[model samples]
Target: MATKRLMKEYNSIQKALSDTQEYENIVSLEPTGDLFSWCGVIRGPSNSPFQAGTWKIKIEVPQNYPIAPPKMKFVNKLCHPNVNFQTGEICLDILQNQWTPAWTLLTTMSAILLLLQDPEPTSPLNIDISNLLKSGDIKAYNGLIRFYTHKYAIDSV
Candidate 1:
């Protein structure tokens, strides 16, 4: 059952990427070895500090997927309030306590893109970045993000 659902989700993701411009930032999302493990790349959203950056991620889908959320994490470094600088762990509700069967991989990736655009400072993995946001230091926050984007995430091809 889980394999069937994952194949469906994976197929739909590939089809959308090929047939439409909607998920343009999602560079790729393909299986690593089998249906349960995958890798993906997402170009950061435009008009944001993370612009031009390429972020890679790993996805480990549980056997009961759709019923239980997949475990995902950045494979590249990202300096953001909701992401751990050293570990690349993400702090997001949908990936955790708020997940539901209704949320598909496409929607989850969309939510991650939204999170990049608008971070939630209240709960954070990088306290320094979150503090900068909370303290209304937009310049410093944007600067740090840009620095990290350059240092950790640009893909030329």
Candidate 2:
């Protein structure tokens, strides 16, 4: 049942990608060698520090997916308050305690996109980065963000 549901979702995502030109370049979601594992790329939004960057993410669909949220992490390094610098762990509520069966991979990615725009500094995974952001050191924070975005996030993959 889990594989079946994932296949369905995968098909739907592929269809959506094909149908929607806007999302075509911004993101790419594809299954990995294993059906339960998937990979994706999210282009940095314009007018942000991450502009010109492309972020890669990995998604693992649990055996009991839909009943539980998928596990997702950035495959590349990013200097963000909600993202762990070392492990790429994401501190999003929906991906953790607040997850619901109604949330799908698409929704999760949408949430991640939103996170890029508005970070939750109080609940941070990278303390130093969070501090920089909270302390109003916009110059330093954006510098770090741009550096890492150029180094790790901008990839052909």
Candidate 3:
């Protein structure tokens, strides 16, 4: 069932890419070898610090996918409150405790695009970035994100 489902998703992504729009933020989503490992590229939304960047992500689907959400991490470094700078581990509820079987890989990537725009500082992986946001230093926070986005997030998969 899991393999069948993963194959469906793989085809879905291919179909999505075939369209002209091809998911506005999703640059690409391709399986590495089999159904379990995949790689993707997500372009940052406009009017945001990450606007000029394209971020790559790695995905690992568990055997019980749908029942268990696939694990994802950034291939390029991203400096944000909810993302671990060193490991690229994301701190979003949907990727963790709040996940539901109803969520698809495409929706999850959309959620990540939203995260780039609106970060939740409360549960942060990068203390410095989180603190800046928590303290209401919008200028510095945006500046750092912009800086890092240019430096690290510009690389593609």
lDDT of candidates 1 onward, in order:
0.89, 0.85, 0.86
Better of 2 and 3 by lDDT: 3
**Of the candidates numbered 1 and 3, which has the greater lDDT value?**
1
Backbone-clash count (model 2): 0
Error of model 2, residue 153, in angstroms: 1.9
lDDT of 2 by residue, 10-111 (tens): 888878877876564447888899888999888888878988888889999989888889999998788889999999899999999999988878768878
Estimate candidate 1's RMSD in Å.
1.3
Report the lDDT tens digits of candidate 1 across residue range 23-66: 88888888899989988888988899999999988888999998
Model 3: per-residue Cα lDDT over 59-127, one tens digit each: 998989888888999989998899999999999898888889888788788899899889999889999
What is the TM-score (0 to 1) of candidate 1?
0.96
Q: What local lDDT score does residue 124 receive in model 3, on the 0 to 100 scale?
A: 92
Ranking by TM-score: 1, 3, 2
TM-score of each: 0.96, 0.92, 0.93
Best by TM-score: 1
